[model samples]
Target: MLGICVCLFAVFTHVLSQEAEEPVFYTCTEGYEYDRVREQCRDIDECALLDDACKGGMQCINHFGGYLCLPKSAVIYISKEGEQVPLPAVPAVPVVPAVPAVPPSQPQVPRSSGNQGVSLSSRTIRCAPGYTADEQNLCRDIDECATGRHTCGPEQTCYNTRGSYTCQCPPGYQKNGDHCVDRDECALTHYCMHRCVNTQGSYYCECNAGHKLASNNHSCVDVNECDVENPCQHHCYNLIGSFLCQCEQGYELAQDTVSCQDIDECSFSSYMCQYQCINSPGSYACECPEGYQLQGNRVCQDINECETGTHNCQDDEMCWNYYGGFRCYPRNPCEAPYAKTSENRCICRSQAECQGLPPSIVYKYMSIQADRTVPADIFQIQATNMYANTHNTFRIKAGNEAGEFFLRRSSNVSAMLVLTKPLSGPREYVIDLEMVTHHLTMNYRSSSLLRLTIIVGPYAF
Candidate 1:
């Protein structure tokens, strides 16, 4: 049984060998021939059969009867004829499946088509989550009065719209102190046509009938009634805003302060009477009182009843006016001076008031009275046109009356009067003096005014 099995196996092996083996023949179309049939018929790696057909980093991959050029990872053998080259082990490579090409005929989607499946929506903008339609539409201004966001500032009026609100002021409220508050136009100053009546946002006024508003709106001025018609009978006086009447000429203002009346001047001489005057109502006439008549002057003058001896004066005397009465005096005693320099003048000799001063027909200022008891400054007197006849001696006296005046006992060389004395107010004094009796007669005359002034000065009886 073992031998039979062996023979069958041998036969099987022989058949397989014959089927696989082929004679090695170099099939060259020309020239080269192989001596070894068996060797030539065997497949050879190009690196092996043709002698190193691949360069470095390349390998020969044996196929059915031919070989393929592969990368170095496929090389299993190395050559000696090339050298005893070291054989780099060929690593087993895994087979990769082929990728199938997509057919160009398949339909492609168009870019213009709206994105449908698998397209994300564009991001949306939304109001804060708590907000609603009442707040805004498309995120616009919101009406707080409607949206419940309204909180008006103090004293401010809030008006709401669809999306917003306005802060305003009610009537008479003005923006002041950076806020809306009650306004007082009169705060600056009271401006009114007449009486200022303050109202909401404005003012009114009450004016008298005779006055009107000034352009500045604060003053009430007089209405010109005279331009329209004359309401006054006589003179019209214009007050601040009204008129009054007053009488003119002979007329007088009546009991009514603004009315007129006619004057009756005959009560105290007529209005035109020069000699007499009167007060009357509104008008007056010119007329004479008793004992007088109209003259070239408007005056009622007295007639001289005595020119015809209604009363008579002495032949040498004259009549003159003594008020409404008559008087007579010696005309020769009052004759006008012959020379112009002596007009209205008279001459007289008077006494003196001091020692060393002579009595003459001259003027002097004062007279001596008592001693230092009466004071000296008040005792000054001038001796007029002195230094006449040599050897003439004089004496002066001072007293309350001319009966006995004081004598100037001495003269002070330094002062006119002692410093211990000062002048008093006006007082009466008397002067008395006498010229020293002498043989030679000397004539001494002061100025004519002095001559008359002595008469006007203090006199002794």
Candidate 2:
């Protein structure tokens, strides 16, 4: 009996083993499922097999007939630690390789790919780091000129080199030289003056020392000194490179250059006038004194004023003016009463008392001061204008023998006079001078020298 029960248990165990190896499927409304792999039953996520597997955002499900497939939205995920966890973001669906259209009999789906082909798992593009199609396309080189990818500034030129281009100045420019070197105008001696200013490679023209350049041309001109402050003492004229100074007339240059002096015309005869001319710095003149008219001989002479009527005498008198002297006449109407008829006194009947008179009783005494000097041609006046009386009958006594004599005279007017003749023999002198009326007289003697009175009278003072 114990052997029979053991044999039945072996058969049951064999049947269960066969069920775990081969699982059975049911229709839409199926029976309860069996799973013998772990000797326990498990539920299925059946929404994956539903007709409309999910809503737009969730999958729909149907469970075995009474076990309906439900949407995944109704379920919540749980962590291994038993805490509720938020649902993770849905992963983007992987794009599969596009298949070409096949005929009706051909297999619609592809077989599993072999490992020999390139796999997405090994490529960075498949690892979620995606690539752009433009980058993958064939890359063209960056043309500097075409794309305007140049570093050169305006007015500069650019040249292309491999991988990069270089900046450059235009023609006639050098690397070390001024990139835009101006042409060196001063290098050639064409328009330069004393010096040249080099700017870059070019220069401007200028004048040299003591010279000025003309606006029209490159020629240099000499500075004109005469036009300015006048370097010359006189007229100034400009020359090519210099000027000339000339001393003007009426002046002479001194040792020092600055000043001019008036030349003494009198010192030299060149510009002197006639008649003892005198010269001034710029002119000349003549000089003459009084009492002397300019004569033909150019000298002063004692005037014979009496003959010339120059003496101030009475018009009624016949004046016999002489050289250096004069004589006067009252028109002698009567002869000398004392004169003898025949070497003897005339005894006229009515004039008996006047007869026998000694011939012309003479005045006795005379004295004078006579030392004198006179001026000449170039000298002053008043020294040469005078006269001496010679015709008067004033007698001198031989007995007196006077060493001195005096002179006096009277006419229509009185006079005061200075002597011109030099005194010689006379030293002691005395004189009595008087006239009864218009006939004035002077009496003098050798003893009267101590009181020789030169009496003055009325005249043109």
Candidate 3:
């Protein structure tokens, strides 16, 4: 088996050598003669086909056209003295020192200042993963941006990194695909006092008329017009965005909101006064006339000048008050021709003849109130002229047709006059009382007369 294997290897080696020496062309179309596969036209790999394609001391290397045979070593072998004949000498090649190799983990710069004896032809260097070697034998970062290799848009900015790059937009802009667009902040929200003005990278606020911007710069506040000036004649009231006028106490606001006018209370028919109504600035006053005073604020009452001692009546006359006026009434009545005495009493000269003719009665006037219905003591007379002892004899008569007054004698022999009923109606009556003495010495009777007046109502005074 070993001999057969050896024989097969020798045949394969011979075949590869013959194939290498003579040119072989695969059968294919003329334009596409060479193909990568062996089934078509292609270059023959002699080393692959036969492991020992080259002879001793020769190296086999395949090429596009054919194969190459190179000498593996060219050194001469000198035999020791007395050993044997020395081998043939090959051509000499100059020796050069090897340069230090830079590790693949780091990059290295070329050593330009070494000894002249040192050679750089055999130097080996490598760059780090993120760096590339330049012609100067130095590592440098790649600039993708300068080389037009960045993917940033026209409006974007490109930044070069170590072996990489970056793309971005400006501060107030947003990245939208290839564009660096301005952000519309105003469109996103209302950020102004009254109106929003959007600008490049900024925004502002504005206020309308009669308004002012607030501290926040995004809202508006009403401007108070009344605070700057007094617009009302009396008082000024401030409202939102406007002003109003108001009047003090008794006044009113005019049609114009800025003016105030006085109100005439007297002009209204509801003004209530007893007798006189007086108007003032914005109000009215109620007053009484000469002889009248206000009972309530709205009613009038007659003032009694006589009772208040405010009258001008004489000593012999009486003062009387009516609704709005006063009058003076005489106290007593007598015949006009009869002269009044010094005491203001009435006397007649015919009294002397009546005294001489019979026992005449002299009538004296008396005034009485109708409220005195119970028997009231009228007079106590002690006779002095003719019948001193006939005090018990008396006669009484009332001139009243209604018979309201009569006279009676008491236990002490005194005369009294009484009314039968309390006088209530508007009427006046008279009473006559006559007294006579039963014992007459000169054959003449003594007589006396009394007159009484029953008065009711105001005239009773």
Candidate 4:
């Protein structure tokens, strides 16, 4: 009996489980339907499926399962008899009327709910002074810009506010009433130092030819011409707005002032040279003639080949010094074996006739210091081969016979002369010395030294 009751209980539990899995169906209302997932009836939101169900002049407001239609009040007007009246219905032609503000003198009337049931008169409505009633009979700001009602020009912009609209200029512009004008940014600010150009909306700075804009974008600065490839052939200097070229020493700037030319130093009269001046590329050189050398780069001094041991003189000849050269001649040509003495002339083996020598050859060499009390030997006669068998006689005479010069023999072989007076100025004195060598072995005596002219003076402190 317990097993039978267990079987019956199992069957009853299965039937109850099946009924819980499959729910029953029910009829739904006009505005509600059943949802299979929830297994219940839910109200439908008619506002989402279709347009608003509000009639006449009303606004639709949605709720949990339904929507409410609220009536919108029309613009209220006061009658000529001071009685409140409803706004007239709009014509089929869609006419828009200007709604005026409710006057303070009129009595206020409450708005209608739109469900008059034909038992109530039209409801009163109102708006602010500048506000107008929209299609839903609600107060809204009039968009004069969108409706083409604003008096602003093309350059002006219209802005709508709570109850009215206004016109204003755009950025970088100015407004005067309904008109707009462009703003001059260049004149209104510290724009540029050089030049300012005004564009449509802004301004810019510009510089001249040899200038550049500074880092501040306002002022101008000079361009450094030296930094670029300048046309100058030498040194280049950059100025404030220009450039210049310069040359070094011994050079000059050309006509264009950009190229350098060599200066002809030889053209100047003050050149430090005695003989000749030669111009080089950029400098000059002092030159002398043949057989001469430059002294102190200015004076031309004779290159004494005899004293310098550069002459080709034979052992039997003597080198004589000249202005620019040296000459070699036999020593004492008068000492020939056939030399003789006549009444007043000397005869020698004639290779040439003997003429009086010039003053330079007669003196040979001479030098005297200023203000010397002692005697100074300026000339010495060389002894000849005839001196061994002859007795020499000497006589000296001064060109200026003022007792300025006196002669005496220091020894039998030489003579010594002294200047007794000091020279007052630069003056040359000539002296003649005649020496007669008596040939005791020969039959006659002849004077060999005739004129030995000496020059002195031209000395100073």
Q: Residue 309 deviation, candidate 4, in Å?
A: 5.1
lDDT of 1 at 428: 33
The best candidate by lDDT is 4
RMSD of each: 41.6, 38.1, 31.7, 25.3
- Of the pair 1 and 4, which is ahead by lDDT? 4
User: TM-score: which is higher, 3 or 4?
Assistant: 4
lDDT tens string, model 4, 378-436?
45654343466777666664364776766666555556555667654223455666555
266, model 3: CA deviation in Å?
1.8
Candidate 2 lDDT, 1-461, residue by residue in tens: 01111011111111011112221111111222223332222233334323333322233333322223223435534343545554333322212222232222231222443332123353211110111112322112344754678766665666543234456654323344424554454563344545556566334456665567666344577777667557766656676666655466667766765456777766776324323555566555553232223344333333455656676667655454322234454333224553323321122233455444332221222222223333111111111112232122222222123433333233322322224334432233223322221122334211100112222111111
lDDT digits (tens) for residues 206-251 of candidate 1: 5687788766565688877655556667767676677777678877
Q: In candidate 2, which residue ranges exceed 4 Å CA deviation? A: 1-190, 193-211, 222-234, 245-248, 253-261, 267-281, 291-461
- The lDDT values for all models are 0.40, 0.35, 0.51, 0.53
Q: Using lDDT as the measure, what is the rank order of every candidate, best first?
A: 4, 3, 1, 2
Q: Is candidate 1 or candidate 3 better by lDDT?
A: 3
Better of 3 and 4 by lDDT: 4
- Badly placed stretches (over 4 Å) of model 4 are 1-131, 135-143, 155-186, 197-202, 208-210, 238-244, 255-257, 295-301, 307-315, 335-461
Candidate 1, residue 383: how far the Cα is off, in Å:
56
> Per-prediction count of colliding residue pairs?
23, 28, 1, 1
Compared with the true structure, model 1 gives a TM-score of: 0.29
**Model 4, global lDDT:** 0.53
